[model samples]
Target: MIDDAPGKGRPTRSRKEAEAARKEQMKRPTGRREQMRRERERRNKLRDKQLAALDGRGDAAYLPARDRGPVRALVRDYIDRRRSVAEYMLPILVVILVLSFIPNPTAVTVVFFLWSVTILSTVVDEIFLVIGLKRELKRRFEPGETKGAVTYGVLRSTQLRRTRRPRPTIERGEPLRDRY
Candidate 1:
């Protein structure tokens, strides 16, 4: 019972009709609203994927321009692998504020001293971080590629590790790879 013709048992379309159908299938949405809807969907998908990657659930290809490349990666790892005085500044400031509220001259003096020391340590720590990071950047990458890297790393170090963007790839005190 061989009932097959060319395209199963259905009547065949002319060549022009088949070509038109294929073109229609491949055509982009004709209306502006439909086009915008499709574009929005694509952007949403990209954004979600990027966020997932930043959270360590997806590939790193979707990382934003600021966080991409080996230079930035090295900077982040360098900052994340060690403790910085800046990391404690926020909590210390909070404590200092609480202590400042006491109705005592001693408390005020202690708060002032604590504030000065904290700020001084943070600045010194940042300077050291910048110097070390610059040295590493020079060893690993060209000078041109490392523009703003010191500042970027310093800013990242200033934040509490738990609150850092891109979420600290390596644990504290972990060793960095020889090459990024």
Candidate 2:
């Protein structure tokens, strides 16, 4: 007959025995699910390292804005609109000049109204460019001192550009263009 003791269904495992079993299972060769779990853990560790590296420097710290599909579309739209204005500027100015020669008062007023709208669009585009630059600069700079000495060193050497010094104008004491 099976034992009917309060602590027994089969033999109850002690805490140490249960822990040892867990360790043994962990040490055993794992299948696909375990491999995936380990891969995920490795990816997380790499992401943490990258984030730590980005936190301290003026330039190295900023991750470029991700190209989310909608955001990319918006950026392309802005660029196209800006380019359209640039391409049309001379033609529009010529039209305005010709319109000024029209003697009718109503035609002059209409030309003036169109010119005002063009000016307003140009101003709005300039404001957007300024705001974008400010945002980009802010993203590139660190908020506070970065962690990890090795990260700081690598970023300084590889990624960060010094503001105070001019870039080298020569390669091997020859003109940079000549070196190529």
Candidate 3:
């Protein structure tokens, strides 16, 4: 007799029956198509999470290695606090673009001159920022602590605060406290 009471062993199907059911299940689209759909859904979710990580919107644990760690966070804060020529570049470019639509040759010449100056100034600022950032990082961190930080700082410096991914956490002109 089968034991149907609590803690009793569950029922089992015969080998032939189990094999037949398995074969039937495999014949349906719910087999391969369902698996592929699940896989695609998983990938889409993972892609969204990764994008959020890139945007600096999620927990620090999910951040990319290039952007992770306290020292890198401090470097980002420092660059964001300072006013950068590169930061103004986007706005100036937009203005120049609008000016380009005017019919006057003088406007075109002015736009060219403005673009040249902005580019030159931004290039010079980026150079100084990289040097200073590297030196400061060296002073504050061990040799091993600063891998890829120079590149990180240079890229961060060029991005405008408003448009930067993983939006700026620290306020503009705010002095960085010794958080390291």
Per-model TM values vs. the true structure:
0.81, 0.31, 0.64
lDDT of 2 by residue, 36-87 (tens): 8898998898666555434432232233333212222233222322232433
* Predictions: Cα RMSD each: 9.2, 20.4, 9.0
Residue-level error in angstroms, candidate 2, position 98: 1.2
- Ordered by lDDT, highest first, the candidates read 1, 3, 2
Q: Clashing pairs in model 3?
A: 55-166
3-115 per-residue lDDT for model 3 (tens digits): 77566366788999999999988774467888899889988987788778767676776776677788888788879889999878888999999998998999999999999
Question: What's the lDDT for all of these models?
Answer: 0.89, 0.46, 0.82
TM-score of model 1 vs. true structure: 0.81
